[model samples]
Target: MREVGDSAASGAGAGDMSAEVMVAGGVPLRRNGDGSWSEPPYPAVCANGHELGPYRVTIGVSHCRCGILHRTAQCNQCGATYYLPRPTDRCESTALDGRHG
Candidate 1:
């Protein structure tokens, strides 16, 4: 096998050449195979031209008014909308000195 640092150590500071790394907003951006860097965590179009989301929206429900443990997601095939029950336990950010119920 070849030595590990033989190549990297030789090319230090000239641009590592090992990998192109970029970190933003606690997320890592990578280079694409097409010689393009990825846009930050956002919606993107697919190869077939369909919009897709890399980020997600997480809804935490302490208790559902519908008496369900986890809220149900209503799928609208035509509109593609998901409706969840309202949250019962109210809470505010600890950074903002808000109280939790």
Candidate 2:
């Protein structure tokens, strides 16, 4: 329900962006027949021809025990991706023990 440009500092004073994620009919997006929720308005294209849209929040990075991190988006070409909930002040992510381009 929140615009991609909407933010906590937009002067609307609606609180942080994290507090405003909702689904269909304000019912909250749920799992589809394929067991995946309809894309949250983010842009995504999978190798398998899966196209998603408008993700509210992007998974910046995910920390791993191997001293690596992962990103939410994966390259359709190489079939590579990462996880989520990375630490603060860090945007660099690790995937499959290598760098992603």
Candidate 3:
């Protein structure tokens, strides 16, 4: 089976830290540039007490009609989907009109 988010950049374990991201595996870190990903990075915590993270490129975002955007990560440990507040300029995500946190 193919591992999720197993891209060429993700495999660069410890390449150019500048060009490569610790989350070169995560969605936000996939973008190639020279700037901060966020002022305060969003957390990827699941209720299961395990850190939710990117397993593949299956991450997404949901935007509430109230204008709260959430960044998402699927738990590799429990196969659960966790949503954190979406920081600006992270991913070109699909928007929704429901509220989720």
Candidate 4:
């Protein structure tokens, strides 16, 4: 796993100091205020343009319901599976969409 950047170190506000870490397959997961990880609000799409679903995050891995690991997701549309890439940071994400304190 790799971290693209740390919001806290960048002088962000206290409520927006979560670090963004890049997991396997380049999928970027944001650290919650409680220290947990979660996917972005927008769904991730596979290379074939198929939408991925049922994104689940555990201890150190994120995956689909199919038991894939390391931020990998499977497309129910075309049965395609692959690692996800880090998405561009957005304003809303910096604040964790208001989900965290």
Candidate 5:
């Protein structure tokens, strides 16, 4: 049996990586015979209750001009965009410093 993190056996190298990998929380996703990735373990539904599937979602890496690597997902149904791991740090100042003058 192939061990976890074995990129060679899992076909999860640079070229073979899929968005399902991130959705699965780093677990290598299975590839179907037709070159499509299998569904992830947990459901990834948007706020609008749109389930993200192979056909209903588009996932990819976005190179922001700020030099940050952003793994993004877009719901094909409603055209909603998402930044994987969600940009929670944007409001860190408000969350961290809870004092107002």
Candidate 6:
């Protein structure tokens, strides 16, 4: 598997990241013979043609406002983001600081 970039600074920094981080093509994607996306989370390519890496978002955080649990793929090349749904058991949601309600 090809590692994108320095994940620490590629897409996540401080509180900017909201999606869970996964490995590249870690979403059980199989390349179809037609060269199309067999599984959505398979080939995470950005609109700019940049390959997206695995990233996770928050799920059941203490005070998460997103409501659902999922992760996001961020392009290590162009810095773009894509949202993908994931099971809550897969990961935990990121808690928001100073959250109320």
Which prediction has the highest lDDT against the true structure?
5
Q: Which candidate is the best by TM-score?
A: 5
Q: Rank the candidates by lDDT, best first.
A: 5, 3, 4, 6, 2, 1
Full-model lDDT, candidate 5: 0.51
Residue 100 in candidate 1, Cα distance off native in Å: 8.0
Question: How much is 96 displaced in model 4, in angstroms?
Answer: 36
Q: What lDDT tens digits, residue by residue, belong to model 6 across residues 1-101? A: 12333242233322324322333423423234343323343344676786555452222213224454345555666655555544345344455553453
Candidate 5 wrongly placed segments (more than 4 Å) = 1-43, 88-101
lDDT of 2 by residue, 1-101 (tens): 54333332222212334334333322233234343444332236654655533442234445444453433665445544423323345444445555642
Candidate 3 lDDT trough over 10 residues, lowest sum = 22-31
For each of the candidates, give the backbone clash count.
Answer: 0, 11, 3, 0, 0, 14
What are the TM-scores, per candidate, against the unseen true structure?
A: 0.22, 0.24, 0.33, 0.33, 0.41, 0.33
RMSD in Å for all candidates: 13.9, 11.9, 11.6, 14.2, 10.0, 15.7
Tens digits of per-residue lDDT for model 5, 10-83: 35433555412323432335655455665333348866889998899888655443333456678889977776
Worst 10 residues of 1 by lDDT: 1-10
The global C-alpha lDDT for each of the candidates, from Candidate 1 onward, is: 0.33, 0.40, 0.46, 0.45, 0.51, 0.41
Better of 1 and 3 by lDDT: 3
What would the TM-score be for candidate 5 when compared with the true structure?
0.41
Tens digits of per-residue lDDT for model 1, 1-101 = 11322221222222335444454322334445555545333323433444444332222333333333332232222222222322336422232223332
Q: List the residue pairs that clash in candidate 1.
A: none
Model 3 spans > 4 angstroms off: 1-39, 42-45, 54-58, 76-79, 86-101
